[model samples]
Target: MPTLSKLVCAALTCLAVQLPAHADNTDGSFQTAPSFSWWSGDKSANNNATGGGGVFGGRSLSVDGLINSAKNLIGLPYRAGGTSPTSGFDCSGFVQYVFKHAANVDLPRTSRDMAQVGQSVSRDNLRPGDMVFFAHTRGGGNRISHVGVYVGEGHFIHSPSTGKTIQINSMDSGYWSSKFVTARRVTD
Candidate 1:
């Protein structure tokens, strides 16, 4: 039977030979090229420095990353028309900030306009990274006046009205469920 060292060497030799071309050393030892990354072919690691996907652009958007980004802003106070972390965020501003920062996708500044940008997604089919819109009963019927990033499990993150901080609320909650206007998917 082959010794463990020999088996490992044989495997490495096969891998090195199968991988992309790289400079060969005079010594018969295995040397992995910088490009020879993800031995298991897992692309989920965003920045492994050895060939993980780079964040940015629509092609690289990660739903988990986007949801995490929105969740990180929880507890931030809401300010009317606010657009940045320093200034705090309103509903639409929170959605805009999360998408632009996490996925490099710029969104309209207002919830109503944002509702027009992406393909409509039914509430039953809602997925993480989808933008969930809402309209208050007293204010414009069916007009989207609020926006949040769905974090899955029927929960969404948003910076609600004045004096309220960013928070995660259940879409099934009486207040929010009744207010839900529609959902849109801005990323794949």
Candidate 2:
């Protein structure tokens, strides 16, 4: 006894409700946040507006924001000793710029100083926001001569060279992996 239009409306409503929430429009794939809730309980209380507290609090947000901001500058031209996007940037300059803008963390001008500022961490234990140092074109037993931000999953973002643009490179890549020196974690 229901009208045809009413029947179609009811069916559509049921379908809509049954569809999973957070489904991507492009492919209708369901997406979920990683279970790790970086911020919780006491940690949340300690993370003031200034972004203090350890990695468990707003620090994670800082890392994520920094990574996102770094990714946004994928094609920026590399300029030696340049810090701002307007002037372009060198490797350390690019890292400093991203951290300053995204996490409000000011880093030293040179890669060597930047490496000295943070706590040393092993490559196997590196987390997001950690710094990865390398010798670049240097040969054996040489000190670290380059640095990049570890954005996670064995990948890093940096201003590679004079003519190269700011971009992500795989840590597993022979060129990079062979040159990799060490990793450091500046923030908790």
Compare the candidates by lDDT and give the number of the best one.
1
lDDT of candidate 2 over 91-142, digit per residue (tens): 9999888877877777888898888876899989877678899886635664
For model 2, which pairs clash? none
Q: For each candidate in the order shown, give its overall lDDT on alpha carbons.
A: 0.70, 0.68
Tell how far residue 69 is off in model 1, in angstroms. Answer: 0.9
Cα TM-score per model: 0.68, 0.67
Summed over model 2, clashes come to: 0
State the displacement of the C-alpha of residue 148, model 2, in Å, after optimal TM-score superposition: 0.6
The per-prediction tally of clashing pairs is: 0, 0
Root-mean-square deviation per candidate:
17.0, 12.1
Give the per-residue lDDT of model 1 (tens digit) for 61-152.
Answer: 76756765775576688999999899899889899999889878888899999999877999998866788999984755897788987765
Which ten residues in a row are the worst by lDDT in model 2?
27-36
Q: Candidate 1: which pairs clash?
A: none
